[model samples]
Target chain A: MLVHHLYSGGKDSSLAAWILTRLGYEVKLVTVSFGLLDNWRFARETAERLGFEHQVLYLPREVLEKAAEIAIEDGRPNNAIQFIHEKALEALASLPEVGRVSDGTRRDDRVPLLDLSKARSLEDRFGVAYIRPLLGLGYKTIRELTERLFIVEIRESEELEKADYEVELRHIMREKGLDPLEIFPKRHYQSRVLGWREKGI
Target chain B: MLVHHLYSGGKDSSLAAWILTRLGYEVKLVTVSFGLLDNWRFARETAERLGFEHQVLYLPREVLEKAAEIAIEDGRPNNAIQFIHEKALEALASLPEVGRVSDGTRRDDRVPLLDLSKARSLEDRFGVAYIRPLLGLGYKTIRELTERLFIVEIRESEELEKADYEVELRHIMREKGLDPLEIFPKRHYQSRVLGWREKGI
Candidate 1:
């Protein structure tokens, strides 16, 4: 069985991929780019370090434009990221080779979250299985698992070089002269995976 | 890391244990009994077949009594089962050797479901992590996975011998001369795990 995991070179998605691999599924780490920036290369690099097959799929530039508009109008990023996340998942699920799709969305995630109804609808529409291994793990548990399983670098959200939609969305926000820092919450930390932790370390 | 998974000898929980085991956690399959019946032995049999360590934990009989009262008063089993599920999780988390807990609850399950707030509260109070591997999987995906991994026996709910709290709770309902059929939905199916599937089968 093959599982496509949305990759952002981040702790949560990396751990999710590791779990699927352990569970006897071949995992393909995929990063979606909006064609606005080359940050998707970060995820590709992490995938290379993790020794998994990696690919970057492109979504239309307008998708990020609409998401940025939503963020600027709402003065927040939750709905905007969630919107792009759905589109990305749809694009992944529509692929002929993709039968199972997963993401790093956790039980405590506010943005890029997929509720049960939407999840079921996605599965029904795409004929794909949506798996979220971290859905039941809370914030503290995820931190513990990531620390035990991976080498990660944590920094402020803006300082982190990652492949998530926020990077591209923020780029558009800047083009509109709206500072993303004003919209996104302060003190947010983002983690980028460096490599796997050795056993007995 | 050790995770104590609430075992019912059913497909959902058995699959959860399999996932935790594959993820490098030492899983102890624990079946909680209200001391009403010996059905927990069914779980012990499956655990033995899977070659995992298993135990039977006894809860207070009064807990079932209260749950039965709630079921009879409300004419439904969702709230009653949820109440007992919370108590069972608390008991599991309270074990000194236990640092993490998990269950078979799925995304679409109405009864015995733990919402985010309660799950977090359980973790905070017990200083343990709660993991639900099946939390994001819907009915179709669960059925597909169980079929691929386990040889299961499917039958009417009442015909299935299981270790879940419902078995004992229904016993209490019968003692009250209440037909559990009235409280539980008709035409429900339950599955018991026979064993694991071969690698190529």
Candidate 2:
């Protein structure tokens, strides 16, 4: 019954680990470091603080170098989602004991379900079980729970605001005034959508 | 050489149609009508004014009825990107001409490349070609061209603010401080993304 909390010492991952621990799951915190020693030390330290078996895996430095290029592709480049999945898989591969890979996945994140795809994909690709305790809960709830649990602030995820990549794309299309989501695709399928304000049904 | 400008009668698609016609593509405009005759009539009239052969294809109606129900799950939900893709595919399927489907796709819209996967799947499944002519242009430039060409304007697309599902999803997530694009991708793939602030990378 080795349950691994893919911990990055962040709020969501740490809190998820905390929840599973309270549930009597034998928890191991999995942190992957990409040459950031401070982060590496903090994640390892936090895992120990939580009284869980802890392990640190170093990510290949190339991943960080490549992230920006992946982030700013002009045409249909695989977004951050794909890169994150690959990196997680790599980390999982290097772990000592991984029964089920759990983490600080929450509804507050983009396409909350997107993780399920990545996890399922990882499971299929690597034969690992990926579980998320915080799937349906929204941002407000996640924030509340994090505070209630006294978990470390969920702050690893940093959105580049104002005239950044997303904003840059928005600028190009916003005045043309398209829905950023339509072009970017929040929905992955092509289904007949109802609730539309169509003139005549 | 029947080139159907898959017109939403909106800026991007209309602009795309405008370009290919000037390139001597012998373009014919096709507007897929689902859920609204008045809207289609309006779109159709715009196509006619462009002096191009216009064809209107109606969706099966049931698809529209199910989009919202399909977007959500037991209080959890998917995003709008899925519905748009589903609708786009439905429209693409009914294209009568055996050539290819063309639309107002531009360089910026090329990121997730929804059309990439969709076109591949459609071509593999049905051998339909999905072509985007404004491949390299940005919205600012497209707007300038639309003015130059005197393209008919559809205020509904503008007033509707385009990507209704996405805007709604953004509104839903924003109340809780969610990233709109991530929420929107719920429809396409459920790949979890980890964000880094302050070299959170």
Candidate 3:
């Protein structure tokens, strides 16, 4: 079996991919770029270290910005993040060999969650199974697994600017004279995987 | 500093007690019994294994039943559980050596949660600090820590009839011809810690 995994190079996504590999599936890591200021090099490096086949798909900046505008208009980032997430799933599901798509979404994830309605729609429209192997796992479990699997370097989301598309969207919103706090709450802890030491390296 | 810890002999409470001990507090494990079908022998055994000073406080069945009735009337178990939990805190706060009270409530716990208002009142009225070290730690972390610290046996909430006070309360309500299901939702996961392997055993 082959699974197309949405890779963000973060602990959750990496763990999700690792789980797929453990489940006897060949995982093709798919990273969606929203044409932000991101180079997505960290994700590429993680895929290399983990020794997986990887691909990067690009989405138009206008599409992402439009989604962000809708979220900002509604005074929330949830809708915007969900929109981008749905788009990424759609893109991954479009792959020819991808009969199944997976992500590292845990039970506790809020913003990037794919609602049941969207998931049902994807399964119906694309005939692709959506899987979240880490759905019931918690932050501590993910961190524990990551620590054991890879020698990882963690950086705050702000420090790893390109890791999250929201950073670019927030920057764009700021340029438009809109306060980012109005759309997104503060003190949310998000981290990016900078690089990793191979096991025993 | 001596802390009174509300214990239930479950993984969460045991882990909470373990955390408090590590943090250098003199932990007095306090288990509240609602005069139900429980002697709380499991809690006593756990306290003994963990080497903590243990106390079992009794709350009148009428008091607990009344709270359940109110919650049934309100169509929610959250309020009823919180009421019982607050009463437990109030009782523990009255102890002279107890400058602080803590619980094993985790981030994902719904019922028996201390709302902001109740927490504030506890602090303002009793001048006792209410702490939940497991507040932000999720289910996985608690279980992992429990597994690491002690050899544990887990039993389902239904299987361990006397472990949770809610079971007896539900029985009482059932006797009153009120369907407990209407008040308390089904498939709630609660557990009893049967025994733990000694450090060297």
Candidate 4:
């Protein structure tokens, strides 16, 4: 089956893509750009190295802003991220070639989580299957698998300059002369994927 | 330090003992018996195989009955199991050589858990440090480590013929002509460690 995987070039996403490839699925790596300071350069590099068809979907600034506004109003990033993720899935589902959508959402992930209600709605509305390959696996399992399968470089999310919804939301807050810290608290132990070496068996 | 580890001859306890040994601690394995139909044969066998000093402490039947009564009263096994666990810790703390007591409690374990208040009281009153080596590690991590470190035999709790508080509680219900099934529901995946082969590095 043709599976459009939401790739962020992170360890979890990379591992999920690797699993799909191993499972004999025709996987297409899709990374969404929210018009942040960073781009999908590393994601493209990862896709090339892993040898999968890659695509970059640019999300409009207004959509991202609307999600950010909701997040700010709710005083939590989780709601905002989930909103953005649903929108991204909707965009992917609109494509005729994409019969299924998948992401790297693991058992431990709280944000960007497709709740059961939302998942059911998407499947019923678009007649598309939503799959999360790593949903059963926890954080430690994912990290261990990533270490064994690929030579990965781990860095702080900020240092990696990876394009994500949070970066754009922070930028919007800054542009409006509002304290980003008030809207979004600093997260600890947020590791971002910089690059990878040889794919270990 | 001489640490008395509560050994059940199960995967979690065995893994906990393995981790403690790796950490260079003088470990003593203790298996508590509540005088059920099942015996401590496998626990003794595991201790012999692992080359640790093994001690089997007999828990009074009345104590187990009291805990079981409480569980029946509350209609929950968690509180009852926790009570039994605390009593076991108390018994271990009374030992002259045992400066600290440890257990196989992992991050995923809900029943038989030492809550913060109980843990604090144990430490303050008895001056015994309670250590749970596998407390930070989840089921996936523990299972992965068990697979890598030792050759394990997995089976249901009933099939193992191992003496545990649960068995004794059920026995008490059976003696009173009460349906044990009503009190303790059948658990699907209860793996007991029959034995291990060569210990991996």
Interface RMSD, all candidates in order, equals 1.4, 21.2, 11.6, 12.2
Best by TM-score: 1
Q: Clashing residue pairs, candidate 4?
A: none
Is 2 or 4 the stronger prediction by TM-score? 4
Model 2, C-alpha of A138: deviation from truth (Å) = 40
Question: What is the Å distance of residue A136 in model 4 from its true position?
Answer: 24
| lDDT tens per residue, model 4, A1-201 | 578999877778887777665434579999987767556776787777777788988878887889868877987777888888889988887788877788887655778876556765776678777766565443434555566566665445563465456776777777878677786777655555544444421
Worst 10 residues of 4 chain B by lDDT: B135-144
Q: Pick the candidate with the highest DockQ.
A: 1
Q: What does candidate 3's lDDT look like per residue over A1-201, in tens digits? A: 688888878777886777666444678988778665565666787788778888887877886788778877889888887788888888778878777888877655776876556666776688776766665334444555567566555444453444555666687788789888888777545555544444422
Q: What is the lDDT of residue A41 in candidate 1?
A: 89
Error of 3 at B93 (Å): 2.0
C-alpha lDDT values of all predictions = 0.86, 0.48, 0.70, 0.71
Candidate 1: global Cα-lDDT?
A: 0.86
lDDT of 1 by residue, A20-61 (tens): 776677889899998878999899998888888999989999
Docking quality of model 4: it rates as: incorrect
lDDT for each residue of candidate 2 in A1-201, tens digit (9 for 90 to 100): 466666655566665665554333577776655543334555566556556677765567566445434544533324643464467654784455654666565533442234434544556666555556454233433454455454333333222211112323333344445444554544332211111121110
lDDT of 3 by residue, B138-190 (tens): 44445545665676654455634444556666767777888888887787455
